[model samples]
Target chain A: MSPPVAPLGWSRWLVPPAALSVHLSIGQAYAWSVFKPSLESALDLSGTQSALPFQLGIVMLGLSAAFGGTLVERNGPRWAMTVALICFSSGFLLSALGAATEQYWLIVFGYGFVGGIGLGIGYISPVSTLIKWFPDRPGMATGIAIMGFGGGALIASPWSAQMLESFGSDNTGIAQAFLVHGLTYAVFMSLGVLLVRVPRPAKTAADGGPAPLEGVQVSANSAIRTPQFWCLWVVLCMNVTAGIGILEKAAPMITDFFADTSTPVSASAAAGFVALLSAANMLGRIGWSSTSDLIGRKNIYRVYLGVGALMYALIAWVGDSSKPLFICCALVILSFYGGGFATIPAYLKDLFGTYQVGAIHGRLLTAWSTAGVLGPLIVNWIADRQEEAGKSGESLYGLSLIIMIGLLVIGFVANELVRPVHARHHIPAQKEAVDVHERQQPA
Target chain B: MSTSDSSPPDSSPSGRRGLITFAWLWVGAPLAYGLYELVRKATQLFTG
Candidate 1:
């Protein structure tokens, strides 16, 4: 189960594809919404009941990443990828059986519980490896891996829709669809398992091979104890929450904002709007995070949070006055959201060094899980209350926008508060050597 | 960021270069297809 090590003069470029295979496959999580309507109609389920699988899947994503991060580091990417393939693919297979048997609980347990573990593990598997491979461009390397996650849905959304169209959206068809998905993804993700390689330790500590970085070699356990880690936690949570605000209700929000306008948006255009946001989300992961390599992580996050708050304000103050203006602002905000996710592993690499970055990154994902729930709850609950009070059009969303702005502002402050880790957190060189050796051997 | 271990230098052999090309194409082809489909869908915003 040990990871494959790169031979002398291995091309670092190969690493991103390995990482992308896993990321893109797990990214199918985002496309789950595409299946929601079909499931509801077929099973006579409520909207909320149909939503159970996706919500549980996200919750599991965070928990598994947090708990399994250290295990991933110890076992290496090969072992991690193999595990992800089994759990994730089996999740679909289980759902196939559930759909065939008409047992919704089985679908939830399979796709949400088992599949989500794959999402978490696959998400972080390539992060530290990419950081190690491209130490000089850590942000860009990690960006390439994470961008696949954002783009995964773009591929899956249409592909799944087409499959449902062909196979029929009824129980038997749904079973066939799930079966195909499981087999296809398992085959696709295998390339990553075959190709992943860890770098050979550098001849010198400065060369950034499995060595202590910037003289700060904090373990993941010690990292969680640092003020720096908590600050990033708040920062990531706030950023994700803010981005998810628009993302969660994008179609509805856009529709409501323009419902009373001279030119209200149609349903088709709203779907297009969602697709546009996905494009922006995927592009931002690569574009802005790569820019972080040039401009620095701190400065780029300042843009994500500080400028992000301003974008919310723009949307609020302008109301539904101009469609183009609203879209541009939302697009920028969503881009910042993607940039935040892509840049964080590099930020962890910066603050704690690479010794336990993947593990630390795993722990930090608890913030994403939190934001995933919090962002939608705050937006939806407030919108529901406003609607009850006879609010309509842009008025229903005004308060939600204000709350989003506040969250971004808090994130901005958290990003600013981040500083270098204290010396006490740095592992001594001898102990660091021993820990690295332990990491290399199979557990 | 202060770091080391660069990914690809200008110097490379043909065999390794071909493999790199293959690896990137393997991922890039799907990503590009997805992007094209997304862009096609997003065009509805203006067209509709």
Candidate 2:
């Protein structure tokens, strides 16, 4: 059956908001840190125990997206958005129930597993559709949508914090917060599911131009066979690891870094720092990525991986010497982190063609899952050991920063390793000629 | 694959430019504020 087409007017404007609903809801994962202290104190859980929901959520986000990419492509954005809305909202509901009943595993299952599915599906749903709609400006289009994901935390963090404060940061408060998130997001995300529609087939091809560079197309199945894919995997893993290492500990790290300085970071100031980092993360998604379209993907990545390494080194070497320098370097690093996420889809488009770029991109997110764990593990483990050794403040994070620098350097090398695939791997001109001849001869 | 027979729309260049300008303005401010926050935080990291 032919899909119904709506008259074009304001519908295009509806797309990004639909994308935002899903992104903003799952993007709450970033604010999980705000609840960590409460979870620890109330549940009498260890840091590692409290981190499980977040860790599992990330893991599921990557895994489900990777596995569900083909399904998303086949089912279309509306279907994908619907699934994301249901799972994501349900995850919140489950987590709320778990919190009220004091079932940690339920929180993990609900928010981590189910919501992660929502994250994975919601993330890829609009990506390809947006790319199709704005072929003239794929980077900017994708950046605009993905930026919502990063910025979602900015809104959620403060709001969740307020809710916790009002409801009481006790277990009951956390439960209420979870309940509110589930109920509110269900309504918010439904707008996307209801409003989203796939572009008409003829319009889809028209939006880009004829002869959409099919020769360079690589299916997600074939994409994994190439060494370029693995190299990018390493590059993404390292970049995320470096950035998240600091991000996961933004509040404490900032306070510790400035503790010895004349103008020590106050509690409120430290919270503001975390908010600022979130903002930088959100902005970098759009700003640096739009910049990437001009400079080319590889060159922008050189900035992300190479300059990122330098930022980490400066942080480690200086050890909180000048607060201005530390903050400046970290901000640049986080911007790159945000840019890395935004620019990668365009990069995939450049290499793989748009055939199944969304799916390919989804599969690549496994690198994020790996870094999610690796970054925290390396940083927190080092910090814990340092604390045991009587180290405090900036000293505890120095080794972690050093490790992050090493990872970034490795990522830099991997970025350097990226080159255009050889012509042999490309679809042959003869095959294309035959296909064209067949089409010309009539079905 | 080469379907160029359709005539282009007759919108004035000024109109197209206006649309582009509008798009940038619409999406630009919030994006800039987000970046400002990053810069502000980075400044704090350095000075504080």
Question: Which residue ranges in model 2 land beyond 4 Å of their true spot?
Answer: A1-13, A37-47, A100-102, A166-176, A202-215, A389-393, A423-443, B1-48
- Model 1 steric clash total: 0
Cα displacement (Å) at residue A100, model 1: 1.7
Could you give candidate 2's per-residue lDDT for residues A345-442 as a string of tens digits?
A: 88888887666778888999989889888988998899899999998889988888878888988999988998876665565544433432232231
lDDT for each residue of candidate 1 in A1-443, tens digit (9 for 90 to 100): 56677766777777889999889889999999888988998888999998888888888889889999999988788888998999999999999999999999999999999998998898889888888888789999999999999988888888899999999999889999999999999998998998898876443436434444445789999999999999999999999999999999999999999999999999889989999999889899999999999999999999999999999999999999999999999999999999999999999998998887899999999999889989999999999999999999999999999999999899889989999999988889767766665566544
Q: Residue A281: error of model 2 in Å?
A: 1.1
The TM-score that candidate 1 achieves is: 0.95
Candidate 1 chain A weakest ten by summed lDDT: A202-211
lDDT of 1 at A381: 97
Q: Backbone clashes per model, in order?
A: 0, 9
Give the TM-scores of the predictions, in the order they appear: 0.95, 0.82
Worst 10 residues of 2 chain A by lDDT: A1-10
Q: What docking grade applies to model 2?
A: incorrect
Best-performing candidate as measured by TM-score? 1
Residue pair clashes in candidate 1? none
